[model samples]
Target: MATLLHIDSSVFPAAGSASRAVAETFRKAWEEQHPEGTVIYRDLATDPVPHLTADAHTAGFADPSAHTPEQAAVFAERLKLIEELEAADAVLIGAPMYNFTIPSTLKAWLDNVILVGRTAGDSPSVKGTPVTVVASRGGSYAPGTPREGYEYVQNYLSAVLGDMLGLEADFIVPELTMAPQVPAMAELVPLFESSRERAHQDATVKAKTLAERLAA
Candidate 1:
């Protein structure tokens, strides 16, 4: 069976966030289809990992075998994160847009995964396999419209992951642009539920196809 990793990185727990709901829905359906498939989850909100430190950078510059204790520890941690990503047949990344971009916690996680020669080699245009990104915004940010001009999450995300890790990024954008004005229980709640439900179904099929590729 293929391995699937689900990661959520929303710092806000008080306000209901669309990205968290969507990620959970996708994870549930994926697990149901692939009952025996290994699943791993990392919630950056509950327990955050440290950002890339000076030690991490120094370690990244050192040779694997000729590293100091601190360097080895940081290197080992980075390796562990990448190994989890490499072993996976599919990946689900959750993020609630913060100031028109991805969360810092999620960015740190990406930093952990985008190791040279591990996720991607020295190539300039390597194609990363598909990764589902569940992104939520308080405003609409889909491309080709005026709203999209202010948005940098999807483009920046696709560029970094696709360019460095070769991941073809897919997106599930359940926008809550009109939420603040709507009635919570009657309007926003139901919208989030149905939107996430729809995204979950789509991601289920995607997960199956990804698994098939891994099994091949």
Candidate 2:
């Protein structure tokens, strides 16, 4: 059976988090289609991965035989994370834009998973994996928006997960998420709601399609 790696990195609670909700829409459909398959769930909000440090960076590049005890520990953790990604037939990541970028927790996970000469670099280990990203932004960042160039989450993910890791990624973005909550964006409430509904629908369709494709 196929395995799916599901990662959630919303600091907000699942109940109100747009990214989490959209990812769940995909996950629910995926589970329905693959009842017997496995799901590896990582809730980064509650179990946050450590941000990349000098030690972690050294551990990733060090030879296993030469790693010190502390470096070995860091290496082992990164190995586990990479192995999970390697083993998965598909991946789902909930990436909520925080401060115009991705959550620190999600960035941490990316740091751990990206291993030079392994997942990336010349001799990349993993490739052709399908990844579905639920990217929820608090404000509008479309091409015509003033903050168009300010959005970094999706572009960063595409570069790392898609170009570097060789994963085929599809993004489901729900923009203007703060419209209802922020008084300054009150006029965009209707647009926000419409975008959210479209995101959920797209998630459902993509999930089912991916499940079927994996099954085939």
Candidate 3:
């Protein structure tokens, strides 16, 4: 059975989070396509993984036999996350914008899983894996927008997940997520709705298409 690694890092739950909501939509579509497939889910907000420590970082480069007890313990925890990514057929991430970048929790997860010669570098273990990221943001950051240059979530992930890790990365962005709640941006609510609708549609289509491709 195909395995999917789904990671959500939004501070809020699905009901209150644009990224989580869209991610859930994709997951539902994926589940429908593969009724018997396995899904390994991690909700970073609720159960955040440990931030990468010096021991964990140093251990990845050192031989396992040389690891001290402290290094061995932390490296073991990091290995579990790396193994999950390696075992997955596909990946889904809800990376909501926080301070114009990905959430710290999501960053921590990435740090744990990324090993220089293993999950990253010239020939990554999970190379060619497809990863769909829901990069929801509070405001518009498209080309010509004032904050366009400030959009770092997709750009950063592209470099890390694609260039460094060799994952095939695709993004579904739901922007202006704060429109409905912010009085000054109330007028953008309509645009937010449209963007959100488009994101959900993209999620469903991508999930089904990916499921079919994996099955093939």
Candidate 4:
């Protein structure tokens, strides 16, 4: 069975909010499809992984052949994140857009995952891994519509990550058509449940097929 990494960058928990609700639906669907698979959850908001420091940044940008003791720790953490991604056949990122961008919490998580030589640009460890990015937004941003200009957030994920991975990228974005004016308590619950359910199921099927190939 493949090991899955579930990254939840929102501040909310499963019990009381829309972002968490969406994340759950996404995770559950994958779990359902890959019952034999394993999942490791990392919630950034509640228990944040530290952001990059000059030390951390230099460590990542540094060459792998030689690392100092302190630098190695930072490098090791990055590799751990990469290992988690590489070990899994797929990845699920639950990130809600904030101000036409992803959350800083999620950004912090990305800062860890996107290592210079490991995941992208020149020295990648794994190629062709499937990734599903679920983005929740308060407003609408569909391609070619009037609101299309607002859709740069998803585009950024695609361009940056796709260039890095050289693989297909699937995005599941749910916009709150009635946000701000309508309380999330009423309008967001269904959307969250449906998206999560679908994502979980999708991953399960993919994992099984990949597992079979690997077993061969």
RMSD for all candidates, in order, please. 3.5, 1.0, 0.5, 4.0
Most accurate candidate by TM-score:
3
What is the C-alpha lDDT profile of model 3 across 94-146, one tens digit per residue? Answer: 99999999999999999999899999998999999999999999999999999
Superposition error at 216 for model 1 (Å): 6.3
lDDT of 2 by residue, 33-136 (tens): 99999999999999987777787799877788998988888788888999999999999999999998998889899999999899998766778899999999
Query: What lDDT score goes with residue 86 in model 4?
Result: 75
Worst 10 residues of 4 by lDDT: 206-215
After superposition, the stretches of candidate 1 with alpha carbons farther than 4 Å from their true spots are 13-15, 123-128, 177-201, 208-216
Using lDDT as the measure, the top candidate is: 3
lDDT of 1 by residue, 1-216 (tens): 867788889876625666777677677777776788888888888877778988786776678788888888887888778777877667888878899898888988887767665566675222455678987777556667568788888888878877777877888877753465566534565665566567667666666666666667
TM-score computed on alpha carbons, candidate 4: 0.77
TM-score of each: 0.83, 0.97, 0.99, 0.77
Ranking the candidates on lDDT from highest down gives: 3, 2, 1, 4
- Mind sharing the TM-score for model 2? 0.97
The best-first sequence of candidates by TM-score reads 3, 2, 1, 4
- Model 4 residue 23 lDDT score: 56
lDDT of 4: 0.67
Question: lDDT (CA) for every model shown?
Answer: 0.74, 0.92, 0.96, 0.67
Error of 3 at 154 (Å): 0.6
